[model samples]
Target: MTGHSAVGWVDIVVILGYLLTTVYLGWLGYQRTRTGADYLVGGRSVHPIIMAVSYGATFISTAAIVGFGGVAGLFGMSLLWLTFLNIGVGILLAFTLLGEPTRRLGHHLGAHTFPELLGARYQSKGIQIFAGLLIFVFMPLYSAAVMTGGAVFAATQFDVDFEVALLVFALITAAYVIPGGLKAVMYTDTFQGLIMILAMAYLLLFAYTSLGGVSAAHQYLTGMADLVPAPLQAMGHQGWTAMPKFGWGATGYDLWWTVITAIILGVGIGVVAQPQLVVRFMTVRSRRELDRAVPIGAVFILFMTGTPFAVGSLSNAWFAQHGPLLKGQVVKEIDAERGHALVGLMKETSPGRWEPVINPKTNQPATAPMVVVAHQPAQDGQGAPVDLVSGRAPTVVYAKGDADQIIPTFINTALPRWFGLVFFLALLAAAMSTMSSQFHTIGTAAGRDLYERITGKHGTEPSVLAMRIAIVIGLLVSVSISYNVREEYVIARFTAIFFGLCAATFLPAYVGGLFWRRATRVGALASMTVGMLVSLFWLLLVKAKEASAIGLVQLVTGGKTSLLADYPNWPSVDPIIIALPLAMLTLILVSAVTKPSDPQHLRRCFPQYAAPQATTL
Candidate 1:
């Protein structure tokens, strides 16, 4: 069989079983869900274990696996720090500092959605409507990015069309989420999370075993430091083994900033304020459930996030050892044209062919270069061998430059077929879990939060129907976006952009509302407005991706500049680094000058403050 063969019947049966089970559980959840509360927050009765797995499953999606996995393949093991930050900041600190209070406040205030919580806390309809609008408008970008990650991986690995892959995912997620609501979403997530945990564990072990164990892999990769591309080296990539040096000095500042600020800090800090994740805190019964959820969430994050980064980086070493040899015809061509300017030196000179390489140390060409060619075997009797060879191409592999293809290629070429099928299922789970949550969140913001706030209606029936409609609309928008932004790198960056915007726009006000009684309505509104705008401006004008995509930067600068066009060039920096502090400062400064929030309101918001204090004994 060819290396890129379709999955076997055994694999197809396994995948079909997974889908049927997910749909069946979703139907069960739908049967139990009757009220808006049950639909939006799982009636706030979800178990701690289920809540933890659901949160982690929603948090780490195709974006983490297929998107950032590609980044790990390019940038190396530095991505592991992101995994640590995810566990430490995203889970541990997020639960300790934010979870319990969010639950209490959400319950006390009768806030099922994030915007409802903000609106009720600040006593402003404007804030509530605006918050909901921000989510409805910007969240599709993130959903699209995640969709692209999974679609691309499926297309590359399975030989399926990308459009078909996207359609299947959208349909499957909508099937469960629209009818079953958050309860169904959680149930499906729990199952998906189990698959992810198992898939990642097996993949990590397979990676190590294929590379002759962990230490040998590291040693081999370190020795191949010379193979680090010139462009990457110029940008301060020392090797895959070491951390990139920080700051704008002899070491490349661009690499440092991209790794540290754009990825690590952006995703890490952003997780605390993520509306989807924050709402997960409100899903469980009490502080005890949330407390129970912490360690499971941590371990799940460790496996799902850490495994991919390690596996992706180590794939580089595996390719170095087992990749293809040069074809004889191409080697002859290179020899014949040795003194002339070589065209497509590294590229295939002919289809399914490549040239010989000169010995790097000796600077001399080798004779009898290894190449795979079809030849007839000697017949023992009157019988003759078949005219063609149809087995796998053992020496036809090459280093893949497309970062998005790295993990998918490795799975297909370096692992057993059953393992490939299992990993594909895991990726499908990642995508569906995340997209379901995102679609549900978007729907809630639009239908329950915005529609009710705008219409001044409190009917439960219409609100639920509106939310279901919004889910359909959200899926359509996200699919359109996924089609438009097809490049994996760009899709991955959009994920970061959404995270950065969330941090900038929501983190300061959300945190302050929980802690500081002095925070004012005007302060919260201003922080949200300024933070979101600044983050968008940075992405659409200052950063190259959206700037080039929109061309606004070119028009404003008369084709000569951008917001950062004349500024010193450094690593790609996430807007969160600049916008988050500014948002906090705006909140604090505005609150300091404005009238204090109503004492009654403050008392209502902070239940702990309302509790009678014991007199000193």
Candidate 2:
């Protein structure tokens, strides 16, 4: 039997059984659902554990697994620090600080979408409309990011065609989501969350031990001190020991800003304003349920994010050791030749076919490098062994032709075939877990924001059916975007860009509406509008350039003039830095300029947790 399929049929049955059971429960949940509230918000009766898992699934995805992890492997461990903040800033502070108020406002105002809540709170439909517009525009991009992550992992690991893989995953999500709505989504997310956490934990421990045990792996990493640069060396970045040096690019300012400040805060802080996530706050039976959810959410994040960060940081240095020659001139050449040589180096270092090195120091029981190679036909009795150091000719080419397909490639090679199957299934769970939730949220917003608002409808069996249909449409749109995303665009980039946009646009209105009584209707509109435009403008208008004697654009983009011709070098700060304050001030100034909205009109403006049991200005 080829090593890839070594697991007996039992593993397949167990994994598929798990999937079927979860899907069935989701369907059961759909059956029990009776109203728009139930379909959209689980009738606002969700348990804390369920909500916690759902939150975890929503936050983490293949982006965390492959996209971010891949980059961490390329860069260094400082990236992992973002995970710490994900829990502290994104989840913890969000839940403790924002959850109650957001939920209260949603209930107080009898709102559903973030827009609806904000509009009703501030006594302005315009706010709701603007909010809806922001979400409708930006959410799809977020979905595309998740899809990008899935594609990268698929292409690298299972060797599936990128488009094909994208469609498969997207369609699968659409199918389940379209039928079941949020109930199906939450149910599946609960299951998928468990699988993701388990998979990451298992993979980390297994890989750590398999690579010649933990102690040896540490020594191997520490011994390769020469691989890191002097600046990096000073900061403890010994390829495996510590963080990367602070700089402009690479493990520099961009990463810190994007990951810790922008993406993390945008995601974590922005949760208060996320129509999809905010609605989840309404799902629970009571504030007590929300309170319960906090700890579970924290633990889930600790598991999901912590494992990936750990693996990503340590594995990055590990891959580098077996990766391309750590040379400046060679590293800058962006050609198929560089890719080929790297691939060769990767192939040669591959232990156990293409598994990760078990131990760098001893090389005893050394596993394959974490890169997958096409299994060519056997020559004689021996399968092709990796040649780890295939420098082209006179210049050590370092395998002369390999790749950095560490995540997927390693998964395919290292585990027993059955375990590989389990790993893939688990990965699917991770993808679907979040994808389902996104589908549910988009549908709910459509139903509540567009359909409910347009139709003036509330709870009903038919409305639930309408929400189901909206789910179908939302799934279709998200999947389509995913299908179209280019292979070059990574998961982290896509997700971060959209999320950054959100932080820039929404955070202003959300926070201001809550705290700034001066926020006027026009102010809310302006804030949302300006924030969105400013964020997008930064990315589109600004151009990034490297320092060069000639010109950065020519040096990097290979043009006679400059790189900005193709694309501008935006600072890539999570637009929140500029957009948030501007949006807030816009809301305040606009409100102050306009007549005060009738105080009687205020009832619909705040959340349930805010100032009202009955809700009047």
Q: Which candidate is the best by TM-score?
A: 1
Q: With candidate 1 superimposed using the best TM-score fit, by how many Å does residue 606's alpha carbon deviate from the native?
A: 1.1
How does candidate 2 fare on TM-score? 0.78
Give the worst 10-residue stretch by lDDT in candidate 2.
Answer: 394-403
Candidate 2 local lDDT, 1-617, one digit each (tens): 11232344676587569767876877787786666566666777677898888877877787677666655554455565667777786677777877777777667666656667777866666666666655665677677767666655554444445677677777677767776766777888888888787787788887577657778776765665554433334433445455433454333344444445544565555544556666677677667777788888888887776666556556644444343222111221123432322222223233445333221111222223322121221111233333433443321122211112345545654455556666676667777777777767666666666676667775534366666677777767776776654433246666666666766677777777666666766777787888888766555433231112225445545653433343221343455666767766777777778876556555445333246358578
Mark the regions of model 2 whose C-alpha exceeds 4 Å error after superposition: 1-12, 151-159, 211-225, 228-241, 247-272, 317-341, 344-386, 389-404, 454-462, 543-574, 603-617
Segments in model 1 whose C-alpha atoms lie over 4 Å from true places: 249-251, 324-400, 460-462, 611-617
Clashing pairs in 1: 254-571
lDDT of each: 0.78, 0.59
